[model samples]
Target: MYRVIQFSTGNVGREALRMIIARPDLELVGVHAASPAKIGRDAAELCGLGEPTGITATDDLDALVALGADCVVFTAQAETRPDEALAQMCAFLRAGTDVVATSFVWLVNPRSADAWLLDPLREACEEGGSSLYVNGIDPGYSGDTLALAALSLAGSADRVVIQEVFDYADYDDGEFTGVQFGFGLPADAEPALMATPGIVASIWGGSVHLLAEAMGITLDSVSDRWETWVTPTPIDCVMTKVEANCVAAVRFAAEGFRDGRAVIVVEHVNRLTPAAAPDWAYPPEGRDGVHRVLVEGHPGIEINSHVGGGEISETFAGVVSTAARVVNAIAAVRAADPGILGVVDLPAGYAGRVMS
Candidate 1:
């Protein structure tokens, strides 16, 4: 059995924690609760599954590392606290603990990351013989895994595209939806968090390059653009409220070009509500959103899939899958040679225990 450290208590981390405990091959050694209020709580209590797992949650990096787990499932939100996340991961890696994480823009395709950004992690991995893998629904399956798998069956491929069409009404984080994405702002205004120049390319570009690299093609450049729609009148969701004429939906795409022709693309059509972007895309009836993979080749192929069919909501199901993508790979990551590992590096048929 692999000894594991679960970091954070967000939706993703909580799900991963549950997965770790359920798998007989995995043992939960320590938990890192990001929220101070949860620091002293039991692991199961932090994740809200039920009874205690006999493991208490801690926020201290030192305490977590001292437990000497074989791997650390680091699901802390890296979007806002990237520097701190990097430091923590490096600390774990240097302490000889492997890591499997949801997503890290810089490390998704480590080959594309700058020396300054990736070199430290590399050095730590080398010094301590640890490994790191980053993946999730979008950067994980929707693009690198799913899109490439679709293209592999194609006779000949001209283009590959991945899209995430989510109704942010189900996203559930008001500050994230309103402040970071500017969902309730004027159409003329830009999201300070994401609209920074080249940010989209930086975030999704790796997935594009990963597809291209697998197809034996190299991208010359990646370009991006975004558009927004207004609510026309007031609208409300669990996340935030949108006033008349405020932005209610956003559609953005980053295209990777080879020889001046677009070869790979990553796109998102996210709305505050399904009613906000009527023409963009929608989940199948009774669902909240869909991820699409389009491969234009000798025989073009399109695959559209979504989460949530049982008792849970699609958004929450997605959160579960995001955690599962990494959490399920704990065994492969633990056994693999030390250093940074990508989705492509994992062994085939990697999975976790299934409920009976």
Candidate 2:
């Protein structure tokens, strides 16, 4: 079994901890609790195992690094503190720990990643002979891997699209949704970061580029677009209360253009309230928390998949699956060459476990 350390105890990290404990090929060695409230608790208390894991959660980053575990399932909140997360990853790498992460999203396409971001990770990997893979549901497997895998069934290719139809009401972190996402903001006010131009492109753009590269297509430029939906009446959402006529959710896309036309695309129709946008496309199952992949080519393909299943909420499904994507990549990352990598760099039909 490969030794493992779960970094953070938040939504995503909690799920990663649980999986590491369950997998026979993996052993839970340590956990880095970001919140002081969880600092001295047993790893089991945070995950839903109903028992002690013998391993305690701590905030001591240096101590965790010193353990020199085989891999660290890093699910820390990298959106707001990317530099700190990058530094932390480097520390783990310099100490010889492979990293399979859902952070520093820009690294999803490490090849085209900005030098300021990619160089340090590369240097760290070289220094300690470790590897790093950044991933998640949207920018992770849902688009890059799963979408590409479906393309093989197509005889010829025209345009490809991955759309996210998710409800954010179960996100649990209301303040995060209210403040960062501005879920209930008025129409005239400044919208959430999610509504900002280029934000979607910044996050999902890498996935778009990865898809373009995989198909041997060169994109002229990548662009983004967005649309907002409002509530007809006050609605209670995970974020603040949405007043009538206030913005409740958004639909956006990051597209890669070639020959003056969009080709590879990643679109999202997200709502803070379940029925906010009826006109936007949703999963054929008419459920939230689903990702749809469409390949417009010879065989014309389409797929709609949900994570965590019907009994589970969309937020739980999305975050937990993000954790699973990286957790399942542990062994593959360990076997990879010492460098910052992605799903494309690894062998196909061979990830998700050390052994089936």
TM-score per prediction, in order, is 0.95, 0.95
Compared with the true structure, model 2 gives a TM-score of 0.95
Give the CA lDDT, 0 to 100, for residue 249 in model 1: 84
Tens digit per residue, CA lDDT, model 2, 1-356: 89999999887888889899888899999999888899889999989898788999998999999998999999998888878988999999988999999998888888768898888988999999999999888777777877887787788889999988888866787666457656777888877787788888888898888888778889999999988888888888555678888887788899999999999989988787667887877665646677888999998999877777668876778887888888988888988889999788887854556333
- Give the distance in Å from residue 287's predicted Cα in candidate 1 to where it truly belongs: 2.9
Model 1 scores what on Cα lDDT? Answer: 0.83
Checking candidate 2 for backbone clashes, the offending pairs are none
Best by lDDT: 2
Per-residue CA lDDT of candidate 1, range 84-195, in tens? 9889999999999998997475677777777876888999999999999888887677877778778888988889989988887867777764576678898776565776
Clash totals for all candidate models? 0, 0
Q: What is the C-alpha local distance difference test score of each model?
A: 0.83, 0.84
Model 1 vs. true fold: TM = 0.95
Superposing every Cα of model 2 onto the true structure, what RMSD results? 1.9
lDDT of 1 at 355: 44
